[model samples]
Target: MDDQLAFRADDQPSSTSPPVWRVLAVDDDVDFQRATAFALSELDLLGGRIELLQAFSCREAALLLARERDIALVLLDVVMETEDAGLRLIKALREVIGNSETRVVLLTGEPGRAPAHEVMRDYDINDYWTKSELSAERLLTVLTAAVRGYAQLKTVASARRGLQMIVESSNALFCSKNTRELSSKILSEIAVLLNLQAEGIVCVRAEEGEGGVAKARIISASGRFRPSVDASLDSLDSPEVAAVLRRSLQGQQTLCLSDCTVLFFPRFQAGADYACYVATERVLDDTELELLKVFSASISRGLYNVALFSRLEEMAYQDDLLKIPNRNALIRMLDMTLKDESKAERVLVLIDIDNFSGANTAFGTGYGDFILGLVAKRLCDAFDGNVLIARVRDDLFAILGPQTQVRAADIVALFRRQTRPYELGQVHSLSSVTMNLGDFTGSAGVALQDALLTLKQAKRAGHDQHAVYDSRLLGAHAEAYRMLLALRDAVEAGHISVQLQPQIDLQTRRVTGVEALARWRKADGSMVPPLSFIPLAEATGYILPLGDLLMRLALQAAKELADAGYGDIRVAVNVSAPQLLQHDFIERFVAHLQAAGVRPQQVEVEITESVAMRTFDTVCEKLRALREMGVNVAIDDFGTGFSSLSYLRLLPADRLKIDRSFVLEIGQVSNEQMIAEAVIQIAARVGMQVIAEGVETRQQADWILEHGCREAQGYLFAKAMGCSDLLRWLADWPRDRA
Candidate 1:
């Protein structure tokens, strides 16, 4: 026979009362079970009564604990069907079942079978007493103390477990950087935190009228309510769930019922609130209710931070004016595209409006912005397939798509249609528009940079021109683009150092000055030659910044040399044509000289013969300005490509350096020596100093000096070295002793 008894004050339901404690009694003796139930019914612990759950054997007690997590105590008999049956049951309860929160007490008809001290300590038995000693009064005393201890332990354990849940839930919720992911994480955490079977729905106030909530929508849901996510709250299958959610939102409070609990929490933004309805099978105790309250606050704050982060992140990755993906996001998109093997047939295209800066000046910035948006929309509409179109920068839009769908001719034709006049505000209208485009066949590494290179070529080819990225155009090895990116990092990390190579007087064999050469040393102790990457730098616009850095270092070295009694030494630095034409380049160079405390005459700017061949007014003016400032300009590789006398006459140059090719062929070929001789004569007629480079042999030096070359540099004197090495070389100069 089984006896189950629940002792209560009255049958009337009251909200103020605590839940009753559940105690399971396991014994085959039906009479003893009833007697024990009668004894436990007479007492109360902490304003809560006890309900004695009946079980015939160990199997029944194990099943009861498995079904009920709230069971407070278990009473087991030692000598039941087996002599140690109750002892084995305690082992299963404490070890196999892992119900450490519930209290276990061992009872024995025979005291000698299991020692009281050993049983209580070893088996996790809380209380042990002989059956004969358990009188009605004694049983009441033992049960009251046991139930009180269980309640305290449960509260502490619940608090610990709840805090752990909150930490885990916060991690899951905040890891998401968008609303969609946030909703999914929030709903999943709610179920885990509540220890429910994932049956819940999150309802947010969609709109509010003067009276109350006009419409509420389900943001997220789980388990049985999962289908209701992102749906109207009114469409819930259970009217009870909907009504409780309404009450929760309207009152801005929490409601607890027999089967579920509704909680209302505030959003970060004012007047915006959300309600969570969780289905539970049993009534929650005070500990669980308080835990819920604390977790709800945590969830609210987590949601607010996530929302704020999402907004900030979007701003970081998106263009502000055009509201499209910026350069950084476009690069990430290209990287992702490269990772996808299926996108092998795709092409990356860069579109640039021809003379856009001119248009921006003529039409004003507002009109320019309107035109950008118009172009973006038209490009999106023209591409039939799914494509990623981004405004990388001002008047520059990039698109990635399959070659089968987007061909180069198709893009040119589409933009050609945009050339038709557009009537703006009936007064101001665009009479015509033209675009330059560059495309690459592969969606692989550095596609944007490749497209950019092609775009530059297009611009050079004139308006409305387009070209495909060809590695042959790069004029470097196949891995040149990768090396370019690495070079940029090297510059920023200060890996580029200036090395000084001595220029000697050819006749005296004495060092005249040093040339500052840019040398790169990587982390793995490998050296990158300037010839390998200088062309890439020039093409990719890195030369401007690189030239500025070298100029500053060269100035500093020149200052140090002048202070070290080598005051007559002049440091010559190679300057690219683009660097000379950059805005404010002269001003910044003057500032660098002032900062280094070096006079303008102590430095020389070296330009290639090819640079003088191209005539830009700004470049010519800047060169003349440098000469006027007492800075010397030298035409490097004078006997090399485009050695035109007209260019030499037009450029404001004070020195001409004979090309290394002529010097290297001095003994090998007669024409090379004659070319070197003619270059020196031209420098004399033009009133410019003459220097010869790559004079490695005694014969080459003798020939250059015989031809009236004033200075020469070669490995015969010293390779490029650091400042310390140069100082040592200066002290050990053979010319000074001679």
Candidate 2:
């Protein structure tokens, strides 16, 4: 018993609080044991709590090991009871006690006394060190590494089990069809998995309407965080939490509250159709991060399925495109508006773009598409407040504004003004388009379809203009519909003819060229002006094929004149905006010149200022190529549109036609004369000749000639005339006359 008392001290637990490690020291010499324990007590493993269990002999150490369960590390000295006693104790620990988790570090005073390699190979000790080389820091370092390894291994094992449980339970919950039930199960399972004290799940629909009012409702909760029967989850008001939830919903991101060590997972499924917020006050580790990522993906898929189901259920009441309310939505809104006392006064406006089909046909189907997209964007941009804008057809849009007809009109006016000059890429230049607005009083109780028909009538009259719906226009549309049908028939019957307008050179005084303009001749031998049928022609896309016919006629006349000793004379043809943008314009024009046996230089293609500026880069490149092939290019009515002098220099042209407005005001306005002079000087500098148009009076023609304008065309020289009149004028030439 006295000999066994040598190990009795080791069986007693140390007095340290929160025991860090229990180390058993084995030595035959009592003083060596006492000295080692004193040295180790002064050591610190990052200020760790340590307990020193002493044993004076190997037998005593073995006895102590059988009693203590938490001995983390063993510091064994060689030659304790015998020369190999420490080594024997290591074997006993492994075989008898089965304490493989405890780390054994061997100590030796004379390493040469034992076969160091053999002893290490025979025992499962962690490390071996000589007493002369041992220090407190070194011992502490070895112990810390061992203890940390043990802790990490335990944590990894525990986390693996936790993850397996989470995955299994999440799969079960996700299989449930009901969103509320699934949400509840998820919250409770996550809470249990994380060992959370409190947990809840909140689902919210973010406001996309006028005021951005969020519709929030707590769907599920568990544990102490659960709300009572009297407690309303919808009334849980915390602006910060709400903002965080909204951000998570919108962005599909997770928000972590480190203060409470809580995590909120916002699940956005089916592109933000539904949002779910899962909140838990549990400190998350690496396992939780992996679990959260997996759970969030499952939740996203579930939410998507739920949203798809809801959408299918509500398919009859939603817009297929733009994802806004549809006719059903509008009717529902109207019903709600009528029910509400606050919305007693409201205005509904039906807007239709003038000649939208004509614009679409002139540009292309692509331009029509761009206009539709622009209309949607502009409508959204203009009335972001209590307003609903929807497209009912290709060219028609509707707007609903509450109260104040004057306010609604102002909004419509602002929208038209803003969208008038909107650019539609390279195809269409900044279009000066306008919306025809028709407003109905809130008290009128008129059907929406009736108002739409009234708006259509106003659009038929003219666009870039508006008219309030009246019974008179409705009556007139019924009559005008017949005329529109007749006009379409006339266009199809080839009732249009090419009329030549001679352009005389101011310097030469002989008819140098004629512009072939279109005219409509009825079966009764009466002629109609271009303004009467051109719009109808453009709208029906008759202009494309019609323009082709006119080109053939114009080129034939030029060829006949050239064949008849008028080789130096040229014919100017005005190209429409649509024709100029056609990809085949150059090929077709060149083909016509070839068939006519006329030089490319004999045909002067005149393009409007607006058309030239809008298609500046494309037109300039095309014109340069045409001029390279000897086709003459001229800018007609240059000052009529907003063209910059810098852009003029960039244009590849043989002539610039000064607009008639400048010539008409040349004698009246000094600024007009200055502008004309500037244009002439710039044209001359760039090696381009200037032709003044609309010179009706002698004073206007004289002012233009005095300003160094090289060419003039107007009544002052000769009014535009038929091909026979041009031929007579050319035959009796007055070269010196202005």
Candidate 3:
């Protein structure tokens, strides 16, 4: 051992040198352990000293290896306590603990028990040698080679870790939507790269010469740096860290010091500089240096893009004046919150300042803006980190979080603040208007729309009120939207038609006129009730096309009737109040009828009493012009609406059709009947021809005929049918009294 030593036994490495390469010697032979320890006492390889560890058995060696993570090599006797104890430990090292970097060499006294060739092939050991063959010089040579291999594997493993981190960082860059995310990812990745805990700060500052502390913004932080993440530079809890980063940023280069390191990244835009400070041991070798350089370079491009994203995010998602999130940001938060099923009691509250527009009008826009800013601050203070608050509109705010934190009662109480005069005049309370409990799944924009619609309904009910979004309200709106689309398609595809129900002279039972009713049939051969789609079309302004289609069908029927020797029979087409109030309704009516070679006298403009009553003066003014043009006007479904004496006296109709409701009861029991008779009397005084509808039985027809309704149309005579069917029936009708 004395002759095999490379250096004197007293020449031990100092503590200031790089970390030692730990070698474990596992052998039950105590003499062999002492000899091996002495042989490599003064040796060093790859700028690291060799520190030998001893264990008398495989179990003891395994326990020592478990505690030390950076062990470089293991020299073991093939037969420790058992014949294959060392071999079993090797298998445990390679498979159980997964320690592939540490090199293992097997040395045994009995060469015949384990053949050298087979042992090396069957195990992952780097070298196999008999105890006698491993002299001090040969062991020295083997130790040097094993240490070299371990050093190479360690470098490769570190490089592999760095590469994996780069891949993960790339994904982080790809997934990061804003600067805060990018900054956070960079910190975590750096922590992993340095093999340290995540204790760092990533600060973004303007170019140092441009301005110093004023432009510094701590974007992301973890562990000890977290408290100062949002603090002003002058008031930072970690002022020493800020100082170091500031000095590094001023250098405009990466700062590698003995105590800490600061990585400088100059963003391509915004004239910004980024500095990352990690609290760990000092920098030493090029591998760590190269790893950090590669990281900084890869993330430098990310920094450029992230700066642009930060600016764009500030503009698109954040409100400029109020310095808070805007509606778009709120939408983003809502989408994230809704997707996370683990979060409980998610609530989105929308606050609308009651009569805000009036306040904006009463006070100036400047004062209104001041009030909005106050409201934003108030909401932020009320919820803090518990909820996400946003200025969703000029006078509205939205809060999203757990229901317990984002409570309507709390919001209302916040708004119950005093509305009194201040230095900037007066401001109104931003009352809680509506809330959406996001217990359902959907897009964020749709959720907000439903909330707004609910707020609209609540406003119609009263003011300073808080309401939850009723799914039925959205359902009704969606139904109307679908109905309008279907109605438009039906009109464009010519699926709408006018079915004429024959109106006869009550005395002669002779067909005098036909009431043209609009009908819609779907591609599936199912009939859509007029009661369902008609009101939707009228309310949604889809009535113009639908009404025009019905008018064309009616005129075509009139022309076909005239050609078939039924010229005296008028086709009464029903027109809704919306269609009648069109700017060119009268002109379009005359032109449409005349274009089909059907005279205005051959068509009657029929409207329901409800339509006429709703737009009484407008309907009277428009229909009087049509009546003067020889287009006879008739009031259908009379007495079912506001048929007061004054409105009846002023109604300018050519005919009055009593509703089927009044006529149905006439045959049932007429002991107390005045509605039909009174309608008849009013029509006679107004000089309007009277017709009764829905007459199925002869008794209803006789009762209506006795009550001065000479013209009638019902299923009793003929049901409403297609024009061809009506034409065939008209040709075979009885011209004389039944």
Number of backbone-clashing residue pairs for each candidate, in the order shown: 0, 1, 0
User: Candidate 1: deviation at residue 591, Å?
Assistant: 23
Model 2: which residue pairs collide? 346-403
User: Model 3, 203-285: lDDT tens per residue?
Assistant: 65543434343356677788876877665555667677778887876666667778788877654422266777777666547
What TM value does model 3 have?
Answer: 0.51
If both were scored by lDDT, which would come out higher, candidate 2 or candidate 3?
Answer: 3
What ranking emerges by lDDT with the best candidate at the front? 3, 1, 2
lDDT of each: 0.72, 0.63, 0.75
Residues 498-584 of candidate 2: C-alpha lDDT, one tens digit per residue: 656656656556566666777667789888677765554454344566667778778887887788778677788777766776667
Q: Which candidate has the highest lDDT of all?
A: 3
**Candidate 3: residue pairs that collide:** none
Mark the regions of model 3 whose C-alpha exceeds 4 Å error after superposition.
1-315, 320-324, 349-385, 394-397, 405-443, 446-495, 507-510, 521-526, 536-542, 613-618, 639-651, 665-678, 681-687, 705-708, 735-738
Candidate 1 per-residue lDDT over residues 554-617, each given as its tens digit: 9889988999988788899898977776567799888998999998888899988888766546
